[model samples]
Target chain A: MAAPILVFGHKNPDNDAISAAVGYAYLKNELAKRAGSDAVYEACRLGGLPPETEWILGENGIEAPRLIESLSEGQQVILVDHNETLQSADGLDAAEIVEIVDHHRLGGLVTAQPLRFNAKPVGSTAAIVAREFEIEGVELPRGIAALLLGAMLTDTVIMKSPTTTDFDRDIIARTAAAVGVDPVEYGMSIFKCRSNPAELPVDKLVNADAKEFELSNGNKVYIGQYETVDLQAVLGREAEIREAIKGLVADKGYQFVLFFATDILAEGSQFICEGDTDFVNRAFDIDCTGKSVWMPGVLSRKKQVAAPILAL
Target chain B: MAAPILVFGHKNPDNDAISAAVGYAYLKNELAKRAGSDAVYEACRLGGLPPETEWILGENGIEAPRLIESLSEGQQVILVDHNETLQSADGLDAAEIVEIVDHHRLGGLVTAQPLRFNAKPVGSTAAIVAREFEIEGVELPRGIAALLLGAMLTDTVIMKSPTTTDFDRDIIARTAAAVGVDPVEYGMSIFKCRSNPAELPVDKLVNADAKEFELSNGNKVYIGQYETVDLQAVLGREAEIREAIKGLVADKGYQFVLFFATDILAEGSQFICEGDTDFVNRAFDIDCTGKSVWMPGVLSRKKQVAAPILAL
Candidate 1:
């Protein structure tokens, strides 16, 4: 067989990142087989998996994606859940990106040749993968459907996220039915299965779902979100989290590292910042210097946290 | 009512450029209406319309899209057929790009917000637009179908260009059936409708359907393609074409200006390059520094010409 195309999501992967990569790789493999091509796709991850992703994979009897750090020059890849170069693989600049399935803002990526880029301004990348399976007339196996649906629910915060559009709702409802689960109940279970925030390594707690973004002025900033049912457990470790992110700022020359803990039950997030906080301060009109600020109804990091900061 | 979002193609509008914009704008308006959105979409063109596009619009009783030079700050827009800022309308950097429907390679675009980017490595953007109408369950008006079909055939060179894929072939066949015309006959009609290259101004002949691309080395280059049934006519005015393009090199500071005229009947192109020819020479293994060189079975500029040159 020919070499397998490495399909992966962004670094510091969350549930959506791993799940969308796995789902899309599966769909692409199916398509290759149907088209009588020898091409193969192998799902891979760039970082430690989120706890919820681990639970969903095990629950569905699927293997955890293999972890890879860098890519060989000319190695083909398909990016899922993210497209920005800084957020992708270490050597993505040298790799050949054959396809992209993302649900994030365009991030100044330039390609020499045309490729398949299917993106939507929807709740999650999993929804786009699921929709593609239907479009290509491929059967979405039960195990795969369950895994993708788990990501859909968590990414959209059980459909309460403002990013959840009619497309997301429609696909989520159908995929939930296919998986034979109530989306909200399933979403809660997944969130509850996450590692205890107070017990996780300080660096892990601060970096599990963080993403690096380049500001308009070309400075880099890191934003992380940790969603939980019990906000107190995460808030209690605020000093430690701030210290961990502060180390990142000092070590990596980041302009700022803003860490937030989202409470799924309360539908709010607590923001903790280290390094220059001017952008965050101006973006939300709130103070977060050396202290955590709770913003109500701010569940989406893409819409609520990163967008406004980048806008500045 | 909210301001109507302007939808436009790239500068140096080709048949596919103008047609894709019109088709996508119509589909978006239909989708907005179905969703009961107060939003409206107005088709616009960034450059002079190609003769074939103007003919098709006139034949269908459809008005040519309003020509626009630049966009106001914060003007919401949708880009079709092309994506690079260098190839788009003036002041695009200050405008908000809400969506992109294109078939070209990604061109280093960055957006603060996620968008609906529906692109494929197909024959034409028109093929993707037609596919969307079916996916959205929107009616394809006969006139609109004919317009998009004409573009599909011309862009693919009647399904002969190497860029033409199964996706393009399937969509073209179905759309041709709907338009009630033979694809080859219709494509030839459009190609013949183009202004005679020999009689046209040398500047227009060189710049029409041209685009500026950024080389990996950070310098800019211009690649122009003129598809005609009469290659001799275009080759006959080599001195004038060279003078016009050489002027662009000095005035615009382009590293090179590579002009090629494709003969639809012969399925080949005659390349007449001005300015730096090192990249082109190394890419094609041919010397066209002073004289025109004929390349057989090279119809698609995107695949046969620009891609190789850009790869360097």
Candidate 2:
């Protein structure tokens, strides 16, 4: 048999990423099998599973891949979803990373080496893989199409996202149509299926869009976004939102905690934060004197906000 | 005091539905408050919360609504994700269904009566709710905006579904931009977040897309989608897929079970079955004599595939 193609998702393996790795691996295996190539394909996950994905996968009759915390020596590793992060993928054999397909911001994990890496600033790595399959003239089975289409649709926010390209839309349209989904209607059903809110907790609200970043001092700071139509309405819940954020800070033991009170209608951001003043000053270019600061025009932490602060 | 707008989501509440109901109620309340009107808004769930939604809600510092079980008399209800189904909403008042914003096909539950229902066959009920916020001139807060945005994006599968419309796209664009999301980057992030899958189970693969409909004889037939890109490549795995379906049938005790195997490239559906002759015969217009049923132009059981078979 040919060398096995070791496929793994990002450090925080999510449903689409994990499924994409699996689906892509399955497809690749088929190609190998048909070509009479000595190759075996296996899917792997770096991190533990999220609760929701766990339930969904269980209900769908998909087996979880064997956990591979880090890449093994001589194992040809293929990365999905994440840009290689050395810290997260520590202990992994770097030479084994032969291919990378991801949709996240490129981080400092990839080594300068020869690899078939494709990083699209699109919505999903699955979309990239889907494009690859299309380009390679590989036929997609319904399951693969469903997962890939789902990933593309989810990532591109149904093509409403600014990251969506004509290519992404075209692929999404074709994939959706091929899967026999009135892409629009099917997308709607997914939304409808998601709206039921019973037995939910308030802490989940804070962490819903939570992310962690390592500061220059190696301290971990947590940033989260809570979007709404009206700032005042969210402001009215400020006590609760703040209380929850404080609780998260205490629990997570982070040096900084920030919540973005974004006004979707106003096209503005209100920063609710507790952290060092010098750090804040450097990050936001604003001088402040208290543990709390609310600023405007900081709606984006990625392009407009985070990078600037990180530079400071 | 203006009448309380009673808000309720679908049966078996999920994160998107619950967040939409709560988030929209908050927005409406804010709008009413700004006008100096004390409009009482109560968020209710159509059914009990699913396990995963519970975790998210709990994490978000939001509380799940009281279990409705069904509709009752005297309460004015605004339907979020669900249509009016007595069985689904056992004890709640149907007469109070003043408005319905849904993304699914209109069921007998709501159509039996005349109400201000908006079922535009979009991707998510949150999109409908988002529209409501826009039309009412209610500004969205970051939390509500993020929640609604997430619901819309996730359900629409990032707008790859055919049911998506210009309205959906416009809303998503405005919302993503307003929330300071590079609609592309944010959409891509959410999709990437969905990639992890180490915790998934084998059974979930078969059940994630399972749907059930009652026959005229009180028999309930369930059809599930187990999509893949290549089935023949894993020739031995077909047996596993089939056995999984059989196990589900035995476990769930359904009158019949049908699994749709779709070929995305070939654009056809392969029906795998373990059901009796009558259920299979009625559901598919073909003989069920121990062979897989291959149908052209069949994919979604909810729309393209199931309706025709059920009508038969």
Candidate 3:
């Protein structure tokens, strides 16, 4: 018998990463069963869950996926939520990536063979996976429905993020109805239940939602986003945050490091950086104090942060 | 108004590439019309159509897509049948790739932003486009149905190639019925109308259907397949074929170049390769006469030839 395929998300997985991996695995397994194929899919994660992901999984009574630090050569795997080798499990290039379901920009990941790659410009990978269920005519269980809806809500900030698409909103409404919950209320609850940054050490806060990227010019940039109801608390600790960013830059040899304190209630974000002030000013059209800048109505890192930085 | 998004296939487009681009554009336009969006989609091609593709287009009375050499920066585009930068149009990285519907392995093509990338491990890109039509609840027009069906038939070699999937077969039957033609009769007609290699120069015959790849070890491999009614005609000129392959290898600096003459009638293939004879022998387990070898029932370059070669 063929070995079961492992489905996983990138390290430091967010809510969408966790939910989409599980949802996509369920969809694949259901399709295989209908076709009488002996293929099995096991959902996994590259690292421990964040506080928000843990809360959602517990609320839905879904078990957290097994943690896998690395994959061996020839191991068959499917990636969800992320496709960049830097964000994936260690030794990912050695593994056979059979499929990828993601909602992020294309990274430097090449496959040795042709596989099913379903990527979309929507707010959440869960929306893409939910659409797959609809396309394949598979009914979603309540737990899966809730998990998918929660993912979409969190990723889109309840349809407020710039990344939200009409399809994502439609999937959010449908899955929310399937799970018997009000999307707005549930979305707010999930955000409220997130870990408080004030309670964590400066390094932990910076690393909690961090993502690293290699620019076209071969320079590495790291961005960390912390979503909260209060941004002033983080702003008050600007010196500590800058210290943490400096430590990350020194340790990882990053050319630049940025942190965004996103206020979910205000639908805005405060951007802090420990990078070249001239580049940051030119990229965002703001005077940098080597500290922080207030950017109202900028909550999407993919569009507002990563796009401009990559363009540079 | 936003400019019309150009939908195109790779260079040296085959039946599947041309048909999928046109068919997908039609489906996207239909969906946009339903949504009352002003976004327009124009079907295009990066290179000229082959004889078989021209014949299929003429039979359905469908206008051919416009030929495009390169795109300017920020031009929105959608790709079908291929996603590799080496095979795509010039200036593809500068253009905004809004979507991709392909059947080939993912290449080193990185998009600046997330887009809709619908790739599948199926036999034909037309099958994926047809499935998209079904998903969007758009009824296929007679001309489109004919073009799509013809593409699937040719790409899968009348369901005889190992690359064909059950999904491809089902799509073939459904699309054939929709076009009011028996699949077998139409498929044979398409094959019989292909360009006769016996009439063309050896160089042209070798270049007509060539595809290039960069193996994991950074070696370049070029594989060209010619579908013919009689493989003996090609085998009879084995010396000339080898000379053509050698010319290609020297001109392109390829590590190896292989030419496969696939017999539609005999359901087998004659392989002629130039360069790295030892590696080719080890890959296929055939004692190379340094000229040609007959591999009965090895009809798929993607599955039978390329996969094994890339594995090395």
Q: How big is the RMSD of model 3? A: 1.8
- Give the winner by lDDT: 1
DockQ of candidate 2 is: 0.01
| Tens-place lDDT digits, model 2, residues B27-127 | 66777687687767878765545443454455446667666555456667767765535224555533455555566543434121223445455566787
**Best-to-worst ranking by DockQ:** 1, 3, 2
Per-candidate Cα lDDT values, in order, are: 0.92, 0.60, 0.86
The local distance difference test score of model 2 is: 0.60
Badly placed stretches (over 4 Å) of model 3 are A275-279, B217-219, B275-279, B287-289
Off by over 4 Å in 1: none
Docking class for model 3 is medium
Tell me the spans in candidate 2 whose CA falls farther than 4 Å from its real position. A1-5, A47-61, A64-75, A86-90, A93-95, A110-113, A191-198, A201-210, A215-219, A224-255, A259-272, A277-308, B1-312
Q: Residue A182 in candidate 1 has what lDDT?
A: 89
What lDDT does candidate 1 reach at residue A128? 98
Cα-based lDDT at residue A155, candidate 2: 47
- Give model 3's share of reference contacts: 0.84
- In the order shown, what is each candidate's alpha-carbon RMSD? 1.2, 27.4, 1.8
- For A193-298, candidate 2 gives per-residue lDDT tens digits of 4312222254554554456766657677777664443457556655676778777668777777777765544556677766544665666666642334566544
The candidate that achieves the highest DockQ relative to the unseen native structure: 1
Worst 10 residues of 3 chain B by lDDT: B275-284
